[model samples]
Target: MEQSFLAYLRGRTRSLPSVAVGIGDDAAVLDFPINGQPTAVANEPGSGVLQQVACTDQIIDGVDFCSESQPLASIGYKSIAINLSDIAAMGATPTAALVTLALPAHNATEIAGEVYEGILEACGQFGVAIAGGDLSTYDGPLSINVTLLGTVTDPWLRSGAKEGDAIFVTGSLGGSLAGRHLRPIPRIELATRLRQIATVNAAIDISDGFSLDLDRMLAASRVGAELDIENIPISEAAQEMSQTSGRTPLEHAWSDGEDFELIFTVGESDAIKLEQLSADELTTAITRVGTVVGRTGLWKRVPGSKLQRVFPQGYVHGETDE
Candidate 1:
């Protein structure tokens, strides 16, 4: 259901009809092909996708996020955070956001205020402005839809990754289940910095866990990946959580979704420069894990063994009755 909705939204486009020219030189009318530019073509400087980072996100009540034991502010922040992640994945800076809300329960004005405040805090963090939005009441879980506008020239797409590209990640992966989901750090800042130093051929946000998100990139780029398990970074909290769940550290490190970390590709040479510049100090540590292989699928290295595709498909969120 989620996939279908996304597909419909993606194909939605407003168009204006063009005039048909009269047959001129040879009994044939020529209409030059106008290639569809990146999704950011509609954006303008200082406003929307002046470059190529157009973002949109939706949060349903019982599913996308829970209202129980969660503050309204956190919910609002998360609503924007997910959209910002998309912008960051494109290596773009978010400039504007439009938030729409559907409120089912009759809550106090204070709750609404707190939610707005949370959204405002997120906007302040990323230099984004709340342009405008809509509000409506429904008979279901509360839902928030945020569309973030960003800009980046020569924007990175999941399809740009070619064989031999080195796989690099910004910040520690996983550990998000340890309260990281409430306010997961969008990789926008890191992505912007990476653009200056790394010749990032392809990239993505580790929102759906390393396994699935990587698959998204794979599908887009039409290639597979090879990850060196020993090299992937692990956070202390994630390690502990893994033990608690009777799982391996690698499982927590690789499968914990909502890390909000950047997993991007860079040429071998620029990867070094990116490493040096990032060593100074980062909100999160960057790590190099693997490479793009001619083999067309994702894989992980076994201890003292061969690299093999292991991790299964990552998280899928929607109205499924799981």
Candidate 2:
């Protein structure tokens, strides 16, 4: 579905010269030129030529949340957080956000206010502002959409990964639906600092399960990955949730969606530096889970076991129940 849409857009729109990065990346990057001369701005102390980046994301009431039990503010917060995660994947500093809400019939004004409160709280945390938005009425479910804009001096991309790079994930994975999904942090600060200290090759936020998002990064880079099963950081929530469930903790880490953590690749030397920095005062905890391989499919190797190809496809919209 995404591919078809991109294909259609590609046919209609011409890739202009000012568009540094286009569709299929985490966000679209556009260069700002002042009166025909390129305007350069420094987002970091010594970095140069920061360009504008933008991305949009949306969520529906029943599809993305339970309106009955979940707080209204949490719904609003998640809407913004998910979009900011995309900007974070580009290693950009978010500047502003525009929101659009489709309110269902009979929804109260106070409920909508609370949702805006949550949205503002998240924006304040990341130092971004609500630039503009639209509100409309709908007969069906409530929906929240957000468009995030930002700037990056050196944008990290999914296609920058090389075969010899090492794979890493910030924080834990899986079981995000255990309350974490409602208020997951965007990792914006951590990404900014991580890129300063280590060379990030490829990056993507794990929104549609770890395995699927990792496969996306690999596909964009035209490379493969070999994960160390023992090394993948499975969240404690995933472990506890798996105690009586049919799926194992590792399986949940691979396939449970909405983790919103950053899975990135870097050089082996940078990986070692990242491990050492994580020990000292790194903002976010990172775990080395895999290495980029020359092959063309995702593989996994448990301790004392041979590498085996695996297809741990994660969540996809429009999938019918069997």
Candidate 3:
């Protein structure tokens, strides 16, 4: 097996497809639209509407998730779904996706099409189109990266959260190990509806669990939060599956990572309207489990400590000292 393969192909050749002008230059001219933008976009007035936000997530053969033993189709669908969920988190509607893949020689034929079908099916159900993407070979573990573009009248972000805001999360958390991880619902429409009724300060998709993601939100807004662990939504599915753990199934919803729900904060100004809209628009319950407070700093309401204890356990970014 090839240990590492990352290089650039630099040259123009007769072998190039007519659709591709030159990839080795400042930019690769393609026969297709990038991010679903039309060649005529420059002519559009008022800067073409932001059709969507583009994001990418990867699942490598030995990292991010499981090894190749996982079902090829599920692996494929999930690769695309993970990125789409980001669009959904911000209340954005995905209109298209681009899928790029790399794999060991033996893994290509076995997984590529199955993955594309996953991408295509997700696009169909979610009302997105497949514009185009690049396919290639590598000498390493399989890696699938999907770049998704979505459109929302207003795209939500983590910087909007503010002090005195109400923090709410949709749907139950935890028990993903029971299978929610393999297939989780994208809260796209719910987010769109939320945008209409709720004046959001900030928003983030819960890919890395609530605590870590929320930490980012709070940090961005320069605020601290107080969470009522009892009020946190725990999935009935998670409770049924837990064997032994003191952190409570709620912790998984709180910090397990990859639940893919949206963790957004709204000010009290819109609380009542949100309640009314949520009733008509959501299948899952949206609960305001806490509030943003003065910069007493980032903390969780863990028992035994003061009512507001610091949460230092959110996901941290680091591997080890080289």
Candidate 4:
């Protein structure tokens, strides 16, 4: 339904000339003019002007969190952190955010204050300023929305992936719902350091399940992937969740959403350079999980078993896996 609705919107909506990227990748990049001069062309290297990157996300009570049990501040932090993750995925520097709140009529003032405390905490940690937004008391559950703005000279796009590229993911995957989902550590510094060290062909954040988000990148790049089951990093939380969930830790790593890690592709030489880096140097553990293939489907290689096609399973808002 999300894809079909997005397709419908794409069919009807016409993008303006200034829109560098619209409704496709992590964020919408716009080629805003700088001092009467147009910014460098989209996807081109060595652009003097910074392209504007914008993204917005919302989290609601009950759906994103249990308002009764969880701290309101954490919920607010998550609202901004998710958008920051989007900005980090674009390899951009987040500058500011506009926060909007939909508060319940009961204890609205106290709830708003607590949520703002979380929002402010995240913004302070990330060096983002709250620009402006709207607030309203409604008859519904608490909801928080954040619109993040950033700038980038050379944006890493999903379509940039090519055949023979080595796929890598920062940090472990799966079982973020154990409590880490609310306090996401956006890889802004890591992404910047990565660009400085090597050429990143394509990049994306694992907001949904790893398989689903990786599939989205592959679809954009018009390529396929062959993953090694053993190489995929399964988190400790995933292991714990697997015990009673009747699924393997790997299955949780593959399809569990809200990991917020980064999955990227690089060339063979660059991949070697990245792999050689110690954990202390990168400040994050990155694993080489797969290789980009020429075909157009996701495949996994299991030990002793033949290569098998795998469905991209993950969180699909308002829809179930078919």
TM-score of each: 0.82, 0.92, 0.77, 0.95
Q: Kindly list the per-residue Cα lDDT of model 1 for residues 1-322, writing each as its tens digit.
A: 7667656644552243321211110011112234653332332222322333455778877766778878889989998888888778777677788898888757735656778888999999889999999888767778889977765665666767888888887777667867778797888777777766667888788877876777677766788888887888887878878877887777777777888787888888887776676445444568888888778878887778777776544577654221
- The lDDT of each candidate is 0.71, 0.86, 0.66, 0.89
Off by over 4 Å in 2: 15-18, 36-48, 302-305, 320-322
Candidate no. 1 TM-score? 0.82
Write the residue-wise lDDT of candidate 4 on 209-309 in tens digits. 99999999999999999998689999999999999999899999999999999999999999999999986798789999999999988998866867789
Give me the overall lDDT of model 4.
0.89
Alpha carbon lDDT of residue 207, candidate 2?
87
> What RMSD, rounded to one decimal, does every model reach?
8.0, 3.2, 8.5, 1.9
- In terms of lDDT, the poorest run of 10 residues in model 2 is 39-48
Off by over 4 Å in 4: 15-18, 36-49, 302-306
Clashing pairs in 1: none
The better-scoring model by TM-score among 2 and 4 is 4
* Cα lDDT, model 2, residue 90: 88
lDDT of 2 by residue, 110-171 (tens): 66798998999999888998999998886878889999999887788888789989999988
Screening candidate 2 with a backbone cut-off below 3 angstroms (N, C-alpha, C), the clashing residue pairs are: none
Candidate 4 Cα deviation (angstroms), residue 40: 10
